[model samples]
Target: MTNKPMVSIVCTSYNHGDYIAEAIDSFLMQKTNFEFEILIYDDASTDQSPRVIKQYENNYPSLIKPIYQTQNQYSKGVRVEMFNHNRASGKYIAVCEGDDYWTDPYKLQKQVDYMERHPACSMTVHAADRVLSDKKKVLSRVRPEERNAIFSVERVIEGGGDLIATNSMVYSKEKVKVLAPFYLNAVVGDYPLVILAALHGTVDYLDENMSAYRVGVKGSWTERELATSLKRINHYHDMEKMFDEINEYTEYRYNSALEKAKLGYRFSLLLEQGRFREAKHGEYRKIYLELGAKKRVLLEMKRYFPNVTESIRKARWKLIH
Candidate 1:
């Protein structure tokens, strides 16, 4: 057999000292017939994350390759994943952030088998369980709407909200490398990668839950404590910019879906800050006008009766949960 690995597991880390070991251990525990290498990029963490990664590298010299940075690259507008991407020497690439861990030992093997059988599929993603870090509660079990489903580019674009778990994603490295410039300029990483893979070929969704996506972890990007109204607005604007880039690249093939996503984020921001009147006057005015009569009436109620609206919101949340 050749010395080269068949799959390269690329993990990116910052200050995830507490969780980094679990992520690395999960990769090490994966039982696959073919060889795979773990390429971890540490962005000058100020915690014990580097130490934990060093232990793994020392233990598995042949399987684990690590890059320790002296300066924080993300703050300098560098794409850390691209660094990992360039170093990967495998036909397939599997991504698992340092805060998350694979639950199934067969996760990599299963995805590889599926990709091997379906030559037309550029990517394969499995289901994952989302857990809250502090409470150690499973927030929700996320999966595709259908099992063993083949998703087209249009379909993938339409199912916009967390359709594919990043930790559960495995894609063709050859196809991913040829993605348009928009992918490199994207505000967020995973969504654009999914879109690029879909654009190349079909995407497969396996229903098996194989990974754990920890939310609200300290120093993690998805932490709720780090999100403020202003930050949310800025994030939405960045998303809008990414959509514009994608629209230009795809020649407006998925403009309808992109427009819906843009409108959704704008509306969400408006609702978050209780800016109902502003929503009725800006570029989002068309979206406001397009809202169903019942929804429009609800917004009008929110504007006129803020206290009542807050009470109703709490009640609705209580009912849902």
Candidate 2:
């Protein structure tokens, strides 16, 4: 292996013992014309993830470099990606969380070739299949609408959560270095990173499905069930903070879209807790008005006679089904 690698694959794990091996093996299976290094960080996993990481590190000494943490830095608000990113000597960085794995062997080769040919494209993401961990069933395919299209910063922000898939993303390391504190400190990583990447250059989409995103797994950030009102509120708070940070970092360039997202989350929180009257006031009033007369009437019905509206909804659902 050369001192300078062509791509750096960064994998973060916390209690992903059962799925770490598959993640490692997937990287090992990549067929590329250039050299790449796998930087796997085990964030003080309470499970057997450390042992699995050790096994791979021992077998593939040159390619797999494992960083076993004694204390979980993520809980302390440490950005593991920053550390892995500093150690990366590659021109491109590919991300795949421990619970997720790549399905195609040519994933790296294709991405690298695309980046080389299109220097203006700061990042490239492909389609991925969402799989439920419990039943091992493929739930859905996630990707943007236009295949092989170049997405501008405004377009990416407008696309919202559908712009790119985290595991399917491979971005230019040089462009990624321009990411601000707003992105590094955000609750979630991928969306902000994509936005930051778009600020530097356009982001491209590849139509190929090359990875599996495992959801509904224990300790999985995106998959865990928010079972309480408090938990749901906390989730929205985090999302709101993320949008606020993005707005500030981008110097209010996408203010309108950001405001819409922030208000959308606030409205969802109010609707979840049955605070309909409060939702009709303040910044949320605009969003409430956008709900149309039918939804507004339904909201009033839900506020005054929740049980009746719920019954009607259930009956309607049953009839439709």
- The alpha-carbon RMSD values of the candidates against the true structure, listed in the order shown, are 4.4, 4.9
- List candidate 1 stretches off by more than 4 Å: 224-226, 277-321
Error of 2 at 111 (Å): 0.9
Please provide, for model 2 over 1-321, each residue's C-alpha lDDT reduced to its tens digit, 9 standing for 90 to 100.
Answer: 567899999999999999999999999999988899999988899999999999999999999998999998987888877878788889999999998999999999999999999999899999988887735579788867646778877777756665677899899989887668888777778887888888888799899999998866767774343645678788888888888888887789889888877778889899879998899999899889988999999899989998998788667534432
**Could you give candidate 1's per-residue lDDT for residues 1-321 as a string of tens digits?**
468898999999999898999999999999999999999999999999999999999999999999999999888888788988998999999999998999999999999999999898899998899987635479888787656788888777656648778999899998777757888887678988888999987788998999998876766774332246577778877888888998999999899888877777887788768877788887788778888899999888888897898788667544433
Clash list (residue pairs), candidate 1 = none
Residue-pair clashes per candidate: 0, 0
Candidate 1 clashes: the total is 0
Candidate 2: residue pairs that collide: none
* Alpha-carbon TM-score of each model against the true structure: 0.86, 0.85
- Candidate 1 local lDDT, residue 29: 94
